[model samples]
Target chain A: MHALQQKIREEGIVLSEQVLKVDAFLNHQIDPQLMHAIGAEFARRFEGTGVTKIVTLEASGIAPAVMTGLIMGVPVIFARKHASLTLTEHLLVAEVYSFTKQHNSMVAISPRHLGADDHVLIIDDFLANGRAAQALISIIQQAGATLAGLGIVIEKSFQAGRAELDAQGYRVESLARVSSLASGRVTFLD
Target chain B: MHALQQKIREEGIVLSEQVLKVDAFLNHQIDPQLMHAIGAEFARRFEGTGVTKIVTLEASGIAPAVMTGLIMGVPVIFARKHASLTLTEHLLVAEVYSFTKQHNSMVAISPRHLGADDHVLIIDDFLANGRAAQALISIIQQAGATLAGLGIVIEKSFQAGRAELDAQGYRVESLARVSSLASGRVTFLD
Candidate 1:
């Protein structure tokens, strides 16, 4: 977590109070070693929680989620952001509004991937508005799966994402939680 | 590779005369153990090639690319299909036509990720028309990087993808190369 916070302080580009881009290492272009560490940390934090699977959204969330699943030796089911020819019709669907892309898109998971017996640990890159996390939780709920916990690489605690998820009684662990971001500077939560 | 072929044989759904969906294991609902085997296979195939980085496209390609990067001890960079606020303006861009999505979208990679000195190994889930590979190749070419090789999980050899890359004189490998798919059955090339 210190490594991630250090990287954020060094290479994280804070475009505005609302937007912080870690594209250099986190999302678009990834540092696999850092991802491995994050994954291991997630595994350590969520150890012995009966995590049957790790779930995430497409694109950015896939790397950390994949690494987590690899470390935990579990299958990773990343809900598709867009409907493809391969994805079937019988899916648990949820609408996600992306502040970054400035649009609402559907996130879907196959019913076959999750069920009442599965305990899913949701993993993702950034937790800002918590919209993506909420969407994945909804998909899990629709599948009648248990929410084991949520793991995030970076959380904007200044936003209400963590607060809302806390009120929802979900156990969430964010490796690096940013208390505030302003003027191209970031402050991490203790 | 045999394990992957076996999974395809058992779980892969042949949807039509041409479309074979392995979303059960390869793309959508991912099997981490299978991906580890795949990453090892790709490493073995491209060993001692001085692959500084592994390149892939967003969404589906991230899992395999991440695994390969983890095994090869290199960074992984995936091109973005849709531009988000995080992606910078200075990017290496190429147009990719998705047959599954039935549309054309622009793929862009950060200039910060790729450079003249880097040797990149491209990985993906499927290679049918080779449009995705070609697009990634163009992005790598734009960055003046060396192409270490290409690794794909599945390839429709009956299609022109492998042929075009072969004509281009690049080393390419698909773990499971399908000879044909018809009447809900698949034939693989030796």
Candidate 2:
């Protein structure tokens, strides 16, 4: 966690008044060593939760989710943002709105991959408005699976994402939580 | 490679006469143990290439690329298929046509992530028509980076992907190469 926090301090860039860009190391260009460490940390945090599968959204979340799955020795299932021709017919689908992209998109998973017997841990790179996480949770619920917990790499605490998810009764854990970003400076939540 | 071949034999589904769906363990729902094994195999194969970074396209490619990067102790930079607020201004972009989706999409990477000194190993889930791989190669060339090799999980030998890449003088290695998938039966190339 300290390592992630340090990386955030060193590499994270503040854009405008609200956006924190971590594409240099976390999203676009990934630091695999740091990813492995973060995965191990998540595995350690959720040590005995009986997690059967790791769920995440496509694109950014795949790396850390796969890393966590590798460390925890569980299967990682990512919801596809777009339904390709190869996608299965029976699927659990949920619509999510992206504040960054300003578009509504559907994330889907094969019904055959998740079921009532599975316990899922949702992972993502960033937790902003919590729309993406909620969408994944919806898919998990539709599949009748247990929600072990949610693991996020970087969370914007100033946003209502945490409160919204907490109100929904989902336990959320984030490596780094930013309380505020003022004048290009980040303040962490105590 | 035997382990991968066995996995393909067991879980892979023949969706159509041309489509082989391994979504259960490869792309949609990932088996982390098998991914690690595949990553280790890739690392072993590209042992002395001095690969400074692992390059991959997003969504499906992120998992295996990150896994290989972790094993090789290098950074993994994935090309973005969709535009986002976090993407940098200057980028290396390429257009690739998807055989599965039946559409052409642009993939981009921040120029800051790649450079002339970097030797990159391009990783992907499938190599069908070689369009995606060709796009990636174009991006690397634009950055003046060295192409160490290309690593693919599954190669459709019946297609012209391998031949096109080989014609371009790029070294490609796939764990499983399918010679044919006619009538829902998969035959591996020797």
Best by DockQ: 2
Looking at model 1, how many pairs of residues clash? 0
What lDDT tens digits, residue by residue, belong to model 1 across residues B1-190? 7888889999998998779988888788888778878988999999999999999998888888888988899989999987777775898999998887789999999888899999999999999999999999999999999998899999999999999999999999899999989778889997
Candidate 1 residue lDDT tens string, A1-190: 8999998988898889988889888788888888889999999999999999999988889888888888899999999988888786798999999888889999999998789999999999989899999999999999899999999999999998999999999999999999888767899998
Off by over 4 Å in 1: none
Interface RMSD of each: 1.1, 0.8
Model 2 lDDT per residue over B55-172, tens place: 9998888888988999999999999986787675888999999888889999998889899999999999999999999999999999999999999999999899999999888899
Model 1, residue B102: distance off in Å is 1.9
Model 2's alpha-carbon lDDT is 0.91
Q: Worst 10-residue stretch by lDDT in candidate 1 chain B? A: B80-89
DockQ of each candidate relative to the true complex = 0.83, 0.89
lDDT of 1 at A151: 99
